[model samples]
Target: MTLPTLTIGNKNYSSWSMRPWLALRWADIRFEEQIIPLGPRGLGPNPDILAVSPTGTVPVLELASGERIWDSVSICEWAHEQAPEAKLWPEVSIARALARSAVAEMHSGFSALRKALPMNIKRVKRDHSISAETQVQIDRFDALLQSLITRFGGGQASWIFGHPTIVDAFFAPIATRVRTYNVKVSAPVEAWCQTVFSDSAFRAWEAAARKETWIITETDEA
Candidate 1:
């Protein structure tokens, strides 16, 4: 069978693309990645993306069977089923539930933070001030991450589940976001984000992102 293809946007700017890419990598799933350049968020639609993705989004996972899965969370779950050994979630039921909740919140919530602080690995702004609403979102995440770290990370695991999991993939870009904007967070979460930032895969992505010449000024406008 041919390897699946993961269509992604430019690495430095595409947080959603990074999610399932990292999850599939952790799953040990051999897949090809195609990088797509992004236009500004509100300019218009890209015909190139529309041609491949029904939803007109990047990060579409085209399977060997010709099935396409969009949405980062869905792609992570699909990859999880393909590689059970990855233990995409916690083995214990309760812990797994909590992990899913966290990941879901990351997937659907945090609009304030997402809007205020987009991911830009190449840019760092010291003392960035987020709005009170954004700060609330950050505080909420800090508390959530603290609880997860206390329960599963044990204060010192490179991953939140004490091992690589989809949850880590879900929040990996937030790691870049916090650092990019110099947002204050709890020690455990900060450390975990650093761990995510330090991974070989992340480093490769960042390296590639730096080399890309595609310019999306809106993503960097913050």
Candidate 2:
């Protein structure tokens, strides 16, 4: 059977790209990827992609059946439909609602963090201080992490949903931000970052991101 094709941007800075990519990899869904390097303007040419997603945004999923899934959350939702057994969301109804809420919050919110500490997984700097806006976002993230731990974490699990679900995918970009910006986070969040970075597929994506030839002016090396 033909799988869907996922279009994305430079993994180094595209937080949106990280979401569905992580879910797809975790679900073991075999799909092709088309990396359109994000420029300073944060867009590129791909008439087909633009036709499917008018915004010309990255992380657009083109299914083999000619169905289009734009937006990161939509892509994850589609993935869940394609791989129901993957448990991308929690099993419990309430928990599932909360999970979807959290992921949606990440998708529509966090403007400060996105503007201040954009994802740059390959850049290893000595000092990584966050801005005031970034700190606010980090604080919200801390609260979210604590709530998740209180609700579904613990035991042998390393993620929010007691298992690696789309919630984890939602925050994977934050893991890179925390590391890249050196945000002072609690031990739980720090440990969670380790778990995310340690994932083989995440590492593979990061590796490819680092080797990418296109560089956005806004994300020039420091």
Candidate 3:
């Protein structure tokens, strides 16, 4: 089968792109990747990316048949459809439903946290401030992780669903964001975040990020 092509942005800071990228890599799905450079003058919607994706965004998944999916959530669902054995969704119906809902929340509910803590893999701000509203969201995130870990996690498993799934990919950026901006969380959330941060795919992305030439100067300074 011809590999699908995934167009991404800087691994150093494109948190949205990291979602489906991590899902594809972790699933062991063979695919091609095109990294579009992003910086002060190169931020999207770049013409190059706009030429390929209708949304003019990164993380567009182009299938061998030429079908293109632009949103991270949709791309993830499509990948899950193509590889059910990858266990991208929980097998149990109820768990899967909750997982879907949680990821949806992550997609739409954390604007304040996101604005205050843009992801920058190259920088670690140990003293960054979290506004009260952002802190509430962060606390909500920790509670969500805690709920899942206590409800579904088993021995030695670090993923929220007791295994890697779409939810992990959805939340992967938040994990990186927390580390980059010194956001505090409960021990369980911290542990879960570490599990995500340590993922082979995430680490691989991090290594590449460290080597990328593109720099978003403001993000680099915390």
Candidate 4:
């Protein structure tokens, strides 16, 4: 059977797109990919894309059944349904809820961190000190991770559930952000980021992101 196709923005910088893309890939789900560059004056919308994603957003998921999933979280759910054996969520009930909460928090919170550490996979490394607002968000994120790891007995696992779950996908961008901005963080969080960056799947995504030519003006931090 033909698998669904995932449309995403530049791999290097599109945090939203990376969430589902990573989850799907890490799960070993077979699918095709379409890359959209988001920077200013990049490739305009394609006629084919305009038909699938009305908002013209990258990271739209097109199911084999011809259904369109526009948002990243929704795509995560869709993947879960398609590959139930993948165990994309936590197996335990409480861990599942906590995982969902973490994912949702990442979905809605951290505006400052998002603004300060816009993903640019190829950009030269440098520390942009966290702003007061960004620091607050960072602290909250740190507390959340610390608590989860403490509860779950962390080691090489991707997230609180002790495996790669939707929560990991949600925060993968934040992992990139923390490293990109060189934000001061506890050892555990830093270790988590290290694990994420070193993952082969993430490295593949980064490679593709660096190859993208699109340059959305809005995301240019330099």
| All candidates: CA RMSD (Å) | 1.4, 2.3, 1.7, 2.6
In terms of lDDT, which candidate is stronger, 1 or 4?
Answer: 1
Tell me the tens digit of each residue's lDDT in model 1 across 1-222.
699999999898999999898888888999999988987556667888988899999889999889999788899999989998889888999999999999999989999999899888889899788899999999998898878888888878468989888888888888898888988998898889889978887788889988988877877777
Which candidate would rank higher by TM-score, 3 or 4? Answer: 3
* lDDT measured at residue 206 in model 3 versus the true structure, 0 to 100: 90
lDDT of each: 0.88, 0.82, 0.86, 0.79
lDDT of 3 at 43: 43
Ten-residue stretch with the least lDDT total in model 3: 37-46
**Runs in model 2 lying further than 4 Å from the true structure:** 41-52, 155-157
Q: What is candidate 4's local distance difference test score?
A: 0.79
My TM-score estimates for the predictions, one after another, are 0.96, 0.91, 0.94, 0.89
Where does model 1 exceed 4 Å of error?
A: 41-44
Using TM-score as the measure, the top candidate is 1
**Candidate 3 lDDT tens digits, 1-222:** 899999999998898899999888777888999999766655446788888889887889999999999999998998888889999989999989999989999998888888789988888789887789989989888888788777877523388888889998998888888888878787777888889877888899999988988888777764
Model 3 misplacement above 4 A? 42-44, 155-157
What is the full ranking by TM-score, best candidate first?
1, 3, 2, 4
